[model samples]
Target: MKIKNLALAVAALYAGSAYALEPFVIKEIRVEGVQRTEPGTVFNYLPVKVGDRLDDDKAAASVKALYATGFFKDVRLEAEDGVLIVAVDERPTIFQININGSKDFDKDQLKKALKDNGLAESLIFDRALLDQATQELKRQYYAKGKYSVDIKATVTPLERNRVAINFDISEGAVATISQINIVGNQAFKEGELLDLFSQTTGGWFSWITKDDQYSKQKLSADLEALRSFYLNRGYLEFNVDSTVVSISPDKKKIYITVNLSEGKRYTVTDIKVGGELLVPEDEVRKLIRIKEGDVFSRELVNESTQSISDRLGNDGYAFANVNAVPELDRDKQTVAFTFFIDPGRRVYVRNINITGNTKTRDEVVRREMRQIEGGWYNASKIRRSKERVDLLGYFEDVNVETPQVPDSPDQVDVNVSVKEKPTGNVMAGIGYARGTGISFQASISQSNIFGSGKYLALGLNTSKSSKLYSISYSDPYYTPDGVSRGFDLYYRKVDPTQLSLGQYNTAGVGSSMRVGLPISEFDTVNFSLGIDRSEITLLTGAPQNYIDFVSAFGSRYTTLPATASWVRDGRDSALYPTRGALRRVESLVALPGGDLRYYTLSAQNQWFYPLSKTFTFMLNAEAGYANGYGGRPLPFFKNLYAGGIGSVRGYGTGTLGLKDSNGDALGGNRKVVANAELLFPIPGLKGDKSARLSVFGDAGSVWGSGDKMSFGDLRYSAGFGLTWVSPVGPLKFSVAKPFNPKDNDKVERFQFQLGTLF
Candidate 1:
């Protein structure tokens, strides 16, 4: 034999004496020292099978393979009488994961982090994995700028070969951004560029908003914002060459420096539409927002590209590609733009799959879809469908995805995923106004009852001055054509003397059934008819008008009231509107056959304009007119009342109308109110549209019978208010100073309205 062959044979023979007396043909394989793992699993992992000849090399190879499986901490192999024996000391399985001392994130979040690092419960306990999980936990804190965070992991072995993994974490304070410097910039000032970033160096509100924290993700986003800022300002060749971030020795302070190169500003020299124009060239050209001589704006260029693509998509071209290729003339500092459009194959939606509904019914969401299955994919329709579902207020979030079906180039599936919220509420609320002492309200309501998208509410409102009990039901989709039907039944009692409005007591019970017909996408017409019985009693200090009203109309009366209204709502959001306009007009007529005959007309218009992402401008106006009909006096109870939260916030509720002989507000037959507000994001809660602060100016007046309503007689007030959509419902508060107030105007400088949706 050769020298190498002789050495290998001698080594194998010597090594065989360690565990096996002699090499023999294997008859069977058996695994021992395993508690949870199956014997078959050990067999499948063995390199040598039952029929294989056992030798020193085979024994060593089998041991190595078993150890590599990670299921065993120790492995041994033995051979006896041609039988292979495999032994393993299995690693302890993780029985539970525990986290402590983490306030920034919850226990579940930490467990998820560990799970992502392969150190979750039921997983094998490996020291390497535990160390990795520790590092990952620290990394999460570091991403949040918590440089002082400390994380320690402990493994406690328990009975049944199981262990408990505990992660004790101390998430430290966020590192503050002490300074931000911009270098190698010539076109824009350092201050100007810094203002574009959401991360601030340090401010008074920094602690609340944490906008001054040094976070990697925030820094990355700020860099992108800077790039966009430069590009939008005509610096087409702006480039961020390098960025340097440094931390203090204590790891509590951070400084950032960015080096940038802003090349020569470029202007648009010419704009042209090239490539295939499936639509008319003129129509496509109109879609381009950029024109010749305008500064080169990357945002506008991208918007134009997306617009062209969307236009093509609307025409059944779901896979359209539109690119704005810029041809730059460095010498002239100008760019010639060319829009290339490619309308690919028309794709159709094969199915509209809805998931994550959980509680909401399939049809409830499907009915809101404007894009039908087996129809051409329309991007606009899909977007509108999402918006409609969002406006339903039954979901916390809605997401739509379009994925191309495999092996089908011209077909796609629409996946709609929704996160449901608490649509049913049973709550009680309390509020206080300057003049009105306190009010208590309780309600139970469901916007999505049993996932049917039906609204049901039962409420009781009790105040020192008034008491009301009401129940309402609404079916948003009463008909396939999108008509809505609803009904309201209410029993209300009002005591004006207790609230400082007027001296009278009125009790009424009424029911109304209404149907709303969709006239257009943004318009609806509603009709309702109801009968009410009201009883009025004059107190010792009752107003003269109240006594006169009772003398003419009697103490008890019944009336049939019919109403027709048209509403056009274009608001972007239902809960907190930021843009668009809403206009409504309604007329109510009490028939002549009733105890009292009267006709009332009212119109309301509101418009919202977004000045910036954080600022919005809103204007609202309302007017009402009431008169007697069929030779009967107008019912005093049906008169229009103004002032208070929905009208003029600085004044008492229903206190802006004409006064009686006792100088008490008697309400009126004519009313006009207008308000303008500047809405802005709360200082510490930027980007949260649910909470807003606004400065408003209000002007309104109410004119009684035989009186003329004019702008000159309006009451004016200016104030600041906060509107918040809290967990319970919307809460509104205002603090105002009246510009013009009579001696007995009953002005309320502070007013608040709070109620649960239920």
Candidate 2:
């Protein structure tokens, strides 16, 4: 007890003496262990300068601030000869970052994204920031169906305040949909339910569209679509109780369970109308296709209301509202619907205003407006005007808005805005084909020069087999009433192969005038007249077949062709077609002053349909025939050959018809062709619109000496093709295999071709 008392007394005395001692006066401050940091930086953080008293509290504060800079791992202060020394160990930054498990995002993209968020390589590592980054990456992966992915980060410190980081990742197998079970769906089978989902099991074209790439976003959208589908089909009380997604232990397979409560099907028991109407009630009711007893279809109800509103607008009530309300009857399992119509103040358009068209002339845009002052408003015409503006191809987006005039109930103003897009193109390129060898082409075109919405083009093409030069100009609104006018002038020269017709050469100049009329929003009809004259040259090594064709035809060819074309273009864009149709019928007659005379008629049609979001179907058919009417046979230069990239595909160019003595096929005067294509995006080029790949099947026949072309003589081919809408123009290359080959066929089984702007 006595020794413990003596020890406590001694400790107290030592503490008191230490506190009573005077504070150290700093003579000089010294810093060490810093290679990049300047001496001034360390001195600036030191509160006690030379000849100042250094206290323990000030020393502690300086150390804390230095550590907070995130540049040092260890900091210390020592006093010697009244001088203070501060030492620091700098923290190393992460120099290299590696992530091991990622399937949804590109590694480089992720790295860049992280860098933008202050997690770049060579930046000092922070445990808290890394945790947040990991969570963010995981969330993104979950959105793309990598819910089971694991990320491991390994960091190594290098010399010079640098560290190397490696993220060892185990991106587990993707969870594919194995089954989707929907409960309480008695009206539709499970297969039908599955069909409604964009994500599905593998199909024959699974490799193309990749519909099996399961994603949570897609699943959520599909669920919403299912809900809408039911509600729109008279299932008013339908509800999805829960959606449970289950994954296997290996994470390779997934199962979805949807619990649904499908309430009783309801029938419309009553219909009520309300609100003021400018048009007669009978007229408005006539527009509603739905009857009282018809099944309660949300689509029909909404469509009927829209029709009523549109009808009111046609009656000069531009600002009108028509809405459908449903009242439920629990006992009868029926619902009564009421369409409330409000034909708001019948206002006149005092003035039509146009804005946002800096480059386009005001008159040019105003002329396209369907609504005009001193005229009754027409909703249909206004919508048509919007479509016309869109079809001009000069604007990225066009919008029309009606802003009401304050205190002027009977007057309103309309504003139209347009966003301009690049509408001019200049292209020059070189290409090669089996028959043409190598060809060069150059073209310059402007769809909307100076925002006038007119089209002008000048082009030149030269190859071993042919040469062409052309100039064209078109005005969509030639007279400001939307009537289209165009004219084209062209010159072309064609030289036949030595094996065909004694190496014949033909040069022709032609001119055409065209007039177009809009049949509907989606259809246009065009009429044209063309006159052409040709001079023929017979070179050395002339074949007997060529001599026969030339003797039957005239030496100086002169013809007049009349053409009528119908185009139903519903495609979103002209350059890249999602769906549309192009059809034409043309007839040519040889002039009386020409060396040879004949009357020929031809018809062609093509249709495109989108099979899915990423798949499309294209169908084409054409037929042409000519017979001597006033003079000899049709000119050889005008003959059609059905084999190549643009034709039968499996055979060489101009090799599908009749063969001559030298086994070379003679071009045909009568031709028939049918083709179908199933198009899909190349796997890695999904968002790339310039290049596309597709599979096609072609079948066609040609007749030279025969009176009538027979389908039995038709040749068939199947192939895969690549289409590139390059800056220079469209290029088509194909590799084909013939399905049927005759004994005397000299056409190669495989062929390649590149076609420029038509």
Candidate 3:
């Protein structure tokens, strides 16, 4: 009787065994209705196996386990002839996903979004995921201010139990901020406060700035901006209580209302220093910008703390902490500030870790670093190191981080990570101009070849008037002291008669070797010497002066030329300089060995002053003088010419110089050019360097040997120019009105070039 009870208890322990079924020992198990899933997979999920005793409990458990796998839509089990048969209907797989009418987002991006939301191709189809994907797409568009977006998802059954999903979308118009109001009373006027916000109601410039568009992100930023504005002006207790946003019934107009409290303005009553002043008290006092009796400013306080911290960091205190603890007296509307400084352990750099230079040589990058390993950590050196690496042009981005060494309080590691960019360019272009017709140019240049940081360039250009071929090579780090070496070879042919410039043509071949010495962080002095050989050919209608010059010096001659130049560039960016200055002073002389013994001196200075984040004022001036030496006249071809787009924009190319008897421009030995411009960002595209618009005024001219240099002789013009860094190349177009022009001057009201300017 006890053995019988044990058997019955074991059966009772089996779950869901109340529905009685005959017990049987399974000899084999067969899976059915599993076309996609393998038989073994069904068996793995099955609770009962071959040679196992089966009953109603086991059968129910097997069906539950198979259903939990979610791979099957229907599951069943049957016992026949002592063999267990498992059945399952596999869910349909997603074969393809199609999205149409998606102009704002890329198709791949949409697909990826769906995949991240648990819906994509080649996955089990779920009707819930289709709705989820639709919502996700709508949410993305809504963030961009598109509130009326409509999405229709369709699931089409395919062969082999697969399904295809297609999302037909109708993205609607952006919801514009029709009105914005500040509900709470404020010390500042509404107009003044609105100016600080990134969002705004409709205005003349709204189309360009898109500030009228309502976005949650922009609203949050505006709130933060409002908070900062008040805090910067002594509103110590300013708070943004609430922000209310609403959209019209049509989903095209949005209104924003911000409620805020304007607290009492505070004035600085006293300033003091405390806590481990490693430097002299007087020195620390000098760093504080806030003063007693002045309006309290959080920005000023932050600056004072940062200044103190940096001062300590200069002395190897890499972990220095500086904080401005303020005490407020609401009754008197006064605040007192105490700058507390903590000069942590004087740490040194234990290791210099460099990464992300997968293709570039490590030594190539290490050479540009100014911060040294195993040395006292100097913040200035670390900053300079980052700047040096950033200016290499080999990397798209450079980042430096100094992290403390593990388990070492006085040791740190300087990590320099770089993102390499393609340093080579292969460009081929065809251009047209009235002066130079049907021009073709091709160039292959690499600034970092084979990751060696060597420079090489080969170029070929031909026009109706001339043909040029050149090759140049340079090693920027030829010596440890930051000296650069380079060589250039070029062959050229000119037929000025082709463009009616002159009835003479000359072909030349020249080679030069140059060395650049870095005198300072932002300055370099370069010296080069070259030899040139040219043969002049006087055409049938050659000018008398040209014939006379050829007769005097002979047709064929060789000259050794030497040049020296000092360059200083302090601009914030090379491509789009908004602040700082660029200055170059160059002198070139044809030595005694040259057929033409002459010397030329030139100076150019360009100053870019930033007026605002998106506007700049630029001033440029250039002057050059050339004269004969050793009783040999300066070669006519070497004479300076000014005009056209790069000089006086309204005048024709090379037309600002003296005119010969044949009505062709005769370049002179002296030149002067000046330009003033108001530069600003392209509408709707702030901070985009690829394109810019500028209004400019220009004045320049050239003087012959017999003519005297005078400002009165300079050509003057004013115009607007557009510069676009297009895929093919940089394109510059300008339309100018000449302020003053002589009747003989060729007036080119519009000019454009599809290549780099310099």
Candidate 4:
């Protein structure tokens, strides 16, 4: 073995020295042994041509440049009869590269990523490139829990100037959290300290959330959270000293240690106000809720300063500023706060400027603004205009700026800029239910019509059991003063599941007028009035069980109904709601001249709570009751039915209400529902805005007879769903399982919809 190795080493040395030769002048330049490389490429790198002179210095420079091209290994220049000849041997690259250890990033995707970074099959790989690739791979691994990883690249040369590369990766065991220790904490227990951090020890879902991954970024954020927690509770001098992370010898477990300094708590000694005040000092002081004898809370101090500023703002001092400075006495454990106020000259808006709205018209933005030019500065109105602009989903970013007029100290100009996004969508999809049975729908709509920020939608659906066509329109700034208005018209044909009964076709046209008024910065009240006339065609399949109820309660042919509704919307956004409450109270009454005369009253309340940065919980409840007073009974078109995306998830569409003997929905009079969800991003799919995934639990039921409402009949469903914001708008897919099932219930394990949310 020693003799063979020595012979190989000597051959390598000879090959290296064969290219080192004295330079000679050239009469002609010729390239030998060229295949993939162009002849011009060799001539471009040659130091001597047919008419040029050659020397050792130029030859050495030429060799360096040729080698830097990374395409050749042995480059030699020879001269004979004053003719220059260049001979070269190319380096073989790994024609195929295969990786073996990856669970977080898909193999195909990782290969593509590597190719983008200049690591590809059949390419000449160097030590520098390999080192960079290894570091990048480790970064991706650390993003998960595999903190310790090993990678080995094995290259095997193949025939025809090629090689095959195989990367054997040993993805070390995932590191799990063994324990978390917090020192120098007295006001809170150890359990409380652990609860403050998102990371935790091993749990049932730790593999999914992966909270065990210890990163410097996460630790820094946790330390800031601890600081805020203590500051809000009057620990004015609290500080975090240091943090230590320890890993086990086996590299499968980790421990965290946090060192904190809990200084003395302080009480309020005195409060003082300085600087100019647009409002009376005594009146501004009343807005500060913090008392002298109370504990010194950082939150309260900030709140008090903000309250004072708001009070001044409402009084026309739009540029008022307030800052709180605290003086601490270590001996007495007391802190004194001083609030400095600055109220700039009261300025009126000189001009309202609009920009950044590429598609939306200037009129649309102007109409939504509450602050008007040549009017006294109103901070509340300016804030309202910003909110109104944000509510228009056409923009991804909306901001307002107040630039002072050059010559006018008392006048300022307002500028509103918006970023536009795609607002048109097309939807072509199908759905199935016991009653609808393989229904297909096609819809098209433009939420920002003609760049005017108006909504217009048209939809059509056809199925074996029914057909529907509808057109709807909405104007958020209907009156040029931020009031909202909308209207809808539809014609639908409903055929019961039991063909032996009958079918009903209904045609209606409706128009509604709405007005919106802001009750506060984050709340608004909307009132609407609408009237519609419907013509009902009773066909042959209306179940025998529902015939009696329909004949007694529903109208015979045509009916006219009038409705009035009051709604309050306090949500942050319509598409991705984080925090809000929606309350609606509506009443529909049959006209005296219509075929049916009756009244129905309904009220619903929905509340959304943000559990964390990535999770939200929603609760909703509704009730409706109808009684015959005059004329005929209520029409079937106005009856309420529950199920599907906006109701219970485990059942078919409109199947939550009372059912006839043949299992056809008879509609309902009362309904109630509650839902909870935990939302997070999908692992390895970060930065993708097309879809959002969540886990949810649903519970609710509907009752026809008010007195029969019972918890025993309540249905329960738990599932996970994926919401995709596709070009055709939002599409939702859910796989749900029933927690409790009844004998006659049709519990669907999977349900999906095109555009709806409950």
Candidate 5:
């Protein structure tokens, strides 16, 4: 009976085995519904593999791992006869993207924006991303003050689980700010506070500048400007309480109000410096702009800190930090400032990195850097390096950053990033003028040739009065010291009989070799040697002077000339100078071997001074004198001529020179011209220097041999001129009336040029 009980107990122990699960080993892993993904990719992401025991936990984890790859939207796992199966539904791939009805923004811009928002071509499509992209496009247009912009997105499925997304955008009318109100102000009037803002209410100039448009960036800038205005005027504790902006129901009008609390004005009681004085204390004190007993000015305090930091930077402390701590005494309304300075370790440049130059050679860019590698980090040198690169005109943008090297406290890497511009230009143009007739021109020029810092130009021009064929080559860095060498060869034919000038023609061939030497930061000295051969031919009704010159010296002559010139340019910009001066002096002499021996001296100077925020005063003067030497007369063809766009704008080309017996202009040997202009941005296009309007007054003249070059002999005109750097090229237009003209002067009131002046 006991043995029977033992057997029953054993049976009872085995009875629970029926409910227990047996471990099933996976024999193989199978991936289904994968159209583009590789089978190995699925296996790599699967948590449960072949020969592994499958369980609920492992199955769940494998499903999660597959979903986490972002390649599948739905995943299912099943076990059939110990073989694990992973079934997935993949998200559709983007086949094509189209954007329509977008005018204010570029199509590429929108595509890039969508790509940045995770909705690019060939990327797995997500419904949430499509919705986000639609809203993002709307936000972009709204930031430009297009409040009524509407954006719609459509997703159409293709055959092989692919989708085509189309974004249709409707950019509505721009929203303008109708009024800007400044409230809670006592010291300054509303008008005064509003005047300080670049953003204004609607005005006559709103259409061009669009300053009245509401933008978050502009609003933030205006707020900072408001703060600076109050802080600079001795308001020590001024606080901007609140700002309220409201738009009308139609989204066309905007109103803004800023509330502020004006604190008591404070005056400076004393100022002192506190820091590790690596330099003498007195030298640091001299750098401070704020003095005791002056009105507390935040600008001066900031200037003082910058001055201290710059002084330290100049002394090799590139990472210096200077701060101004002000202590205010409420009882006396007094403020005292202490400038704290920390001069960090003197850093050196460890490496120089150049980027974003896909076409230019690395050495070509490195040669322009002023901050040498393995040298002390000088901020001024770094800044000059960027400036030098910008002056190359090979790049549209140039930026430099000095990032400290990791694990090296006193070492930094200077990185230069540049956006390259088109270095070569091919131009073909046809121009017309009353004085010169119709002309056809074509030119090919490249400033950077095959990424080398070399220049080449080929040109051909055909005109009723002149025809030219020329070629030139230049190497800016002929030597390491920044010397430039170049050569020019040209053939030209001038037929004055086709125009209203003298009835004579001349054909010539010339070649010249030139060198430029950099003398200082803003100065250069150039020397050139040239040889020329010309033959003159007389047509019907040729001028007597030309007939006399050809009769005296024969029809053909060969000459050699040498020239030396000095130029100093301190202008802030080369293309559009706003404030600075340019001076050039040159002397040219024909050698004794030439048919004509003559010397010419010429000087040109232009100065620009900013009179206000918008207006600039410019003064330009030019003088030239040429005379014969070694008992030979100056070549008549080489005589100076004045008038036209480059001289007196209202007069015809070369019309202000000496007169001949046939009431035609005769070239002269002496010339003087003076011009004064009030330059300012166009009324609506304020701050756009690329397009400008100038009110100018010009006076100039030409004088023959033995004729005096005097101010009284100069012609005068007053006019306005427009200049634009357009998509095609630089354009200039002028309209003027001569102030005082002789009866014989040819008046050309309106003139314009397409390519270059004169």
Candidate 6:
């Protein structure tokens, strides 16, 4: 026999004199010392079964395997008269895991973490596992900057081989960044560079923003931001040498230091394209933003590469590669660039998949996709698909990915993932607005009904002075070619005495049919035709013009109105826009069949430009003109008005218009409004883009039909405001001071708009 075999035989036979086994034929197997584990389970783990010859090797293997099950803390095998005996000292099962005195994290969350680490209730207990769970708890607290947190784990055995674990935690105060220093920066002031960082030392807003909290992840992001700041400004060789983070003795204060190397700025001396120019050289060359003699910017260089790749993608090359190689002349601080392009396999989309829409139908999303399955991939189309989905406003986020198909070089799949938002509401709310006063509204609407992407609404709005009821519906894909059709039915009653626009009451009931046609990706034209019946009631302070109109046209009149509108909305966000311009032009005409004859034309232009990483500058302008035509007058109730909430904020609602002898505002036929605002994130709400602050200047006016148009007549005001795209709806609040106010002009210092979907 081999020495190893002999040793095993000796060890197995001499293990226990009371129950020793040599080479024996086992008649039966019995398991002992198992309180919870089944006898069958013990037999299942045995390497040798009944009627099998049991040897030293088999006995040793059986014992090793039984111990490996982890159900037993100890396992021993014995044989008596050809019967194998399996004895095990079972490990106690964990009955419960308790975490106490943990305010920073929830007990359930900690338990889940332990479970993920293979330590949880009903699992076999081991001191090693307890140590593991303790370490995991400490790691979690440390991640939250709780460097002084202490965790003590205790295990208590119970009946039936069960145990309970308790983790007593002492989570100390979170370490806060007391100071942040940037070294070796010469191109910009220290404050300027620091302004680019998302992390900061303790400041007025630190409590909410948590910028003072020490985070390795945030530091890494800040370093990347610094790198981008230099690289975009022509410091092509800029780098972060090192970063040091220190905690005070009490582990409550953290100090951070960033060392940087700002290399000399370089200018582009020459730019050229090389390699596999599937497209025309001129076309690719024109895609580069960095021209000869221009300062070298890594951003522009990367843009050039992406553009080249996209241009190739337009021709069905899904995996195009564009490499920008630079030759540097250190003495002259200039760089010569060459872009090498490789148009890879022209792959086709194998399939299109949509996910994350619980209510929206798959077909609705599929219809919005510009990139179709089984077609050659187009980067522009894929991007457009994402934008179109976002424009639906049915989702909070949209992500599109094209993953290469396994083992298929020429195939890829388009995966569209969306995070849906609430697109339906059955809500009632009360709100106060500067112009509309206290208002009550109840609405039932579904913008994506059953995920079919149709819009339907029934609404009622009531105020002390006015009331409105409306029903509207729209099918955006009415014609399948992206044409939209909708109709509105509404009844409204208004009394202007309380509103201060004029001392009169007017009621109107109308219905309109609207049709929209998409002219391009970002532009749409809509036309609506409607018929309305209007009644006017002149009060004690009614204007002369209103009395005259009521007397000439009678108290009640019927009119047919037709409107046309064209809009190009290019803003990145419909709410809190930071970039792009929105242009809208509309015209309305009272048809020849109506009791009144007049025409109006209006234009609005708005631009949002990012001034810096932290600020956005927005400029908006609007103007309108209306006049009587064909020997008829523009209706008094239809006159254009400007001032207050949306116009000159410090001025009373519609009070910038001309005033009559009765001291009532008589709205005009011509109107103009202009606004300039600097928008920034609220101090402590940097991470929450749904809310923001803005300082704005507003100028507006309304000229009577007999008055001349002049920019000097525009009422001007300046103020700060808060805008929040809250979960319930959009809310805006403003406080303003008029720069100049005429003696008779009504001035209001504050204004707001808050309503459900108002």
- For each candidate, give its TM-score against the true structure: 0.90, 0.66, 0.83, 0.64, 0.85, 0.94
Per-residue alpha-carbon lDDT of candidate 2 for residues 356-399, written as tens digits (9 for 90 to 100): 78787777777777788766666777787777777667789999
**1 versus 4: better lDDT goes to:** 1
lDDT of each: 0.85, 0.75, 0.85, 0.72, 0.85, 0.86
Model 5 spans > 4 angstroms off: 1-43, 50-115, 119-127, 149-174, 185-212, 229-239, 261-271, 279-304, 329-336, 495-503, 538-548, 708-710
> RMSDs, each prediction?
4.1, 9.8, 5.3, 10.0, 6.7, 3.3
Give the winner by TM-score.
6
lDDT, candidate 6, residue 215? 82
Give the runs in model 6 whose Cα sits over 4 Å from its true position. 1-26, 51-60, 356-358, 419-422, 756-758
- What would you estimate as the lDDT of candidate 3? 0.85
Q: List pairs with backbone clashes in candidate 6.
A: none
- Badly placed stretches (over 4 Å) of model 3 are 1-107, 124-131, 152-173, 182-212, 229-238, 262-271, 281-304, 328-336, 495-503, 538-547, 662-667, 703-711
lDDT of 5 by residue, 335-389 (tens): 9998888999998999999999999998888988988888988888888789889
Per-residue lDDT over 1-758 for candidate 6, one digit per residue giving the tens place of the 0 to 100 score: 11122223335444643234357677888887889999999888778889999775676677677777888877766667777777778999999988899998888899999998889998989888789878888889878889999898888988888998988888999998888899999989999998777878778888777887888888899899899889888898999999999999999999989999999999999998899889999998899988999988888999989998998897789899999999999889999999999998899999999999999999889888999888899999999999888889999999999999999999999999999999998988887777667889899999998889999999999986689999999999898778999999999999876767787888999999999999898899999999999888888867677788888879887878899999999999887688999999999998888788888999999999999767999999999989889898988777888887777798888888678886668888999999999999998677688899999999999998788888778789999998887766678889999998888899988888886433
Best by lDDT: 6
Which pairs clash in model 1?
none
lDDT of 3 by residue, 1-758 (tens): 00111123333435533445678989889887888888888888777788999866676667677777878777656667787777667899999999999988999999999999989888888888778888999988887788988899998999999998889989888899888899775588888898777777867767777778887888898899888889889999999999889889989899889999989999999999999978999999999999999898888888888888888887899989998888999999999988888898999999999999988898888888877888898898888889888888989899999999889999999999999999999888886665777788899999989999999999999888889999999999999778999999999898877654667889999999999999998999999999999998887867787888988889998989999999999998888999999999999988886777989999999999999778999999999999888877887777788888778898888888777777778889889999999999776566478999999999999999888778789788998999888877778889999988987788999998776411
Q: State residue 288's C-alpha deviation in candidate 2, in Å.
A: 4.5
Which of the predicted structures, 2 or 5, would earn the higher lDDT when compared with the native? Answer: 5
In order of TM-score, best first, we have 6, 1, 5, 3, 2, 4
Evaluate model 5: give its lDDT: 0.85
Estimate the lDDT of model 6.
Answer: 0.86
